[model samples]
Target: MLKIAMFTLAAAVTASVLAPTAHAAHSRIQFLAPSGNIGCQLGATPDGSGFAWCKADEHGWVTPQSDACPRANVPGAIGEPGGENLQLAEGQAPCFGFVMSQLFFDGQYAPPTLGYGEKRSVGSITCSVERAGVTCSDSKSGKYFQVSREAYKLG
Candidate 1:
């Protein structure tokens, strides 16, 4: 009786741990290519927030990993092609804990643009857009990136 009870308990615990991973593995990757001069292929979540990679354009790719709006938000709608930047705003407050990344012409890591008082985190790197363009710092690794643009340059 004891062996049976222990076996049943262990099986239940294992099932609980593996259920979420199984469900996540089943997530589908959908592609979206809108009509017009967008010149990009977007991969979005079922709730409508993901990434876009453009081909043969000065700007490379942009990703907005947010959990707010769920109705087909595009990179052009924010500010792309012209500014070559993208933002990821999360949570109910909308723009809080946002992470933005800019696509550089030289295929380098461009610091993301932030709002007047917005702060963002990408892994161990924390960044923000100030009057001097976008500045990112990784305290753990003692690394940083700062790019300067005109005031109010971020769109």
Candidate 2:
């Protein structure tokens, strides 16, 4: 009985000590910019007319959301959807009733590298179907940098 109790106590202590460290290690790579006010709508006319509502937030969303284009690849930086035949295209700038604002990643993103207070401008938005289902195109929402998650591959 004494040996069993000792083993149990040891195991519990070991687990408690290592649990937080393990979680922190896996918690690298954070989204850091355009961290708020994200929405999605179809290409419609002016005056917010004929606008359709899609999913608002995509953070931690496991389901895939398709983009204007069909498919894309990640970690490659710039991704062009469709085949070599059709060139990837970007819609017009966000207007009163044109491109609809879609998914958002609003939060203080700080990977282990840059730490915090680092800002990356999401230049162009690309619509790609990733393993996580359909991912939003790299729009102003995706402008980010490789601060820390570079070390780990989330795939």
Off by over 4 Å in 1: 1-113, 150-155
Q: Candidates' TM-scores?
A: 0.27, 0.24
Per-residue C-alpha lDDT of model 2 across residues 41-110, encoded as one tens digit per residue:
2222222221111232323323222243333222111343321111111333211112222234333532
- Report the C-alpha displacement of residue 6, candidate 2, in angstroms: 0.2
Pick the TM-score winner: 1
For model 1, residues 1-155, the per-residue Cα lDDT tens digits are 99999999999999999999997743322111121111222233455433332221222234334444323233334322123322222211111112133233222332222345454453343444344344444445453433332211111
Error at 51, model 2, angstroms = 28
Q: Note the Cα lDDT for every prediction shown.
A: 0.35, 0.28
Q: How close is candidate 1 to the true structure, as a TM-score?
A: 0.27
**TM-score of predicted model 2?**
0.24
Q: What is the lDDT of candidate 2?
A: 0.28
Model 2: ten consecutive residues of lowest lDDT: 145-154
Candidate 1 lDDT at 16 equals: 100
